[model samples]
Target: MPEVVVITGGSRGIGRATALRFARRKGIRLALVARDETALAAAADACRARGAEVLTVSADLAAPDGPERAADAVVARFGRIDVWVASASVFSYGSVLDTPDEIVDRVIQTNLTGHMRAARAVLPHFHARGGGTLVFVGSLFSQIPGPYVAPYVAAKHGLLGFTRALRQEMLGHRGIHVRIVLPASIDTPIYERAANVTGRTPFPLPPVVSADRVARAVVRAARGGRAEVAVGAAQLVTRPLRFLAPRVFDRFIWTLQRTLGLRHRPAADTTGAVLAPMHDPGAVSGGWSRVPLRHPRSRRR
Candidate 1:
């Protein structure tokens, strides 16, 4: 039987790249899940073009039953799931007080709770099958925080903890694997789809990499490479800065936020994709300059 993979948020960014990566291989089946039907179709078409069997599930991970429904939909079609890459997430750009309660809640729901829900939805199948992999695409923000985007950072921090705890619990199921890929900001539609209440435009912290970079890491982890994989060199640099010089870390982060993270021009406040999905089916890249250059967005009306 072919390897059956369920990828949440597979229509865009790291998830999209990961899907295509897997599609290039032989005997791979992909289930692409996201809120946009158009986007899912677009992604599935791309994967199919690459020679992988594709199923697109249009579902929102933030909804209470969303993850379960998506999993059920995939299982109904594929019969079994070999790997679950929980990569569906949304971004919000604003200070804690500036961001509305709903937006904050939605970000946590999508980024953190969604991953947890995905695990709940799929682990039973893993136990039944006697082996499977769960790969959560996390962020460097999960380890080191910056100003603005508080909800994303907090949720990712929670995701890191969730991964650790889940890994410990999976000890009984020797064939069950839990992994996290913590990449420094990679180019993705997330910034473009983020809800931005802050006047300044949101951009990724510098040293931006392609979504393919993270996709590669996701692929490796899914194939039982490592429990925790950090994608960018900056992901390595940030940790020591946080631990060795806490005060310097704070100043450095603030400076980066002020200069690079936020663009010079002011942006309109819109709840980009928090309340809903973007109109575009989306793509593998955010249209940002690749690594060795960089930047990082909002809610829509």
Candidate 2:
């Protein structure tokens, strides 16, 4: 039997890259879930070109029944699901006070609650099979929350807590594996799709890594069943610094937020793609590679 994997938010970004990565292995089956039907079909076609079977399900993960439905669709097409990647998320860019309540609620619903629902929907099948892997695509913000993205930060933090609790709960289920992949700023379409109230275009912080880097980490965790893996040099460096020199790290983060995270150009306060499906179904890269990298101090200057 081929290994069957279900990836939420698999239409683009890290999820899309991860799908392509898995497709490299012959005979693997992929079930991709996301809101855009056209995008999902396109992703499935790409995976099919890689010698893997693909199933695309168009569903809004934010809806209460959405995750369950996606899970059901996967099980129907493929007898067993060996891996479940919770990568569906929405980005919100604004201070807590400035962001609308609806945007905040949507972020929590899609990022946190949706994953929880996905876990619930898959755990039974995993237990029945006697073993399976759960991979959660989190962010470095889960540790050191960034400024101007209050809702996104909150959702990621909640997701980390939820992953920890789930890991503990699955302790006795010998074969069940729960893993979390935290990546630093990567080149993804999330910035373009984010709800921005920050008065300027949102972009990933310095030293932006490729989405393929994060995708590789996700695949490695699935194969190895690692408890948690943080991708990117920036993410790995900040982890220890945040623990050793708390005050210094706090100051550094604040400086980066004030200088590099936000821009002064005027931007219409639209909700971006959070509330609706994107018409374009963007490619893997967000064109961040063209943006010159700048350090915190340089940004301040």
Candidate 3:
């Protein structure tokens, strides 16, 4: 039987690349899910051109039933799901104090709750088959605290806890596989979306890896059954910085925010078009893009 794989946020960036890569592999079926119908169809078309079975599900994973609907749609079409990849995420960058309650809530509900819901929806099917792999497309922000994007950082950090707890619960469980892939920065539309929230440009992390690189890593994790993998040096450095100087790191982040003129904009609500102090996505291609380099928004000079 061809392996059936479900990928959220499959319209663009790493998710799209992963779906495309898997579609090219023989004996692999794909279900692509995202909120954008147009992007999802485009992604599905690309995957279909590769001679792989492809289904596109347009659903908001942040809504209560969005995850369930996406999972059910995939299972209904493919019959069985061999892999579930949670890649759909909303990016925001702003001070917790200034960010609206709605933004904060939405971020958690989408990034964390959506994953939980998707996993729950698929676990039964996975167990029924006696085995399956769960791949989490988490960010390096999950490991370290970022200054301006407090809500996003918090959600990512919470995901790490969720990942670890779930790992402990599922380890050695009959044929179940769970893993996390942390990527520092990849060139994607996510940067632009994040800019809307944080008013920042999306740049590579001084040496940004391509979305293809992260996609390849996802494929490798799915094949090798690795517990966790980090895709870039930005994560490599940030992980240790958290442990080495916790207070200093926080202070550094504070100083950077102060120095970069990046702070919560004076706005009553962040729901609509509110011009907030923003920074670039920070070297998403790992400093390889044409965008001019700027000081870190979360780090001091």
Query: How close is every model to the real structure, measured as TM-score?
Result: 0.96, 0.94, 0.85
Backbone clash count for every predicted candidate, in the order shown? 15, 0, 21
What's model 3's overall lDDT?
0.73
lDDT against the true structure, each candidate: 0.89, 0.87, 0.73
Better of 2 and 3 by lDDT: 2
Model 1 over residues 128-173: C-alpha lDDT tens digits?
9899999999999889987898999999999999999999999988
Error of 2 at 27 (Å): 0.6
- In the range 1-301, model 2's lDDT, one tens digit per residue, is 7999999999989999999999999899999999988778888888999999999998988999999899899998898899999999889888888999999999999999999999999999998989999999999988876677878889899999999999999999999999999988888888878898878756677779899999999999999857888887787678788899988888888787766666564577889889998766556777675564532323444
Best-fitting candidate, measured by lDDT? 1
Best candidate (score: TM-score): 1
**Residue 65 lDDT, candidate 3, scale 0-100:** 94
Candidate 1 positional error at 283, Å: 0.7
Better of 1 and 3 by lDDT: 1
- Per-residue C-alpha lDDT of model 3 across residues 152-257, encoded as one tens digit per residue: 7787888878888888888767777888898886665564445334554433344556788889999988886568898887776666767998888788756755
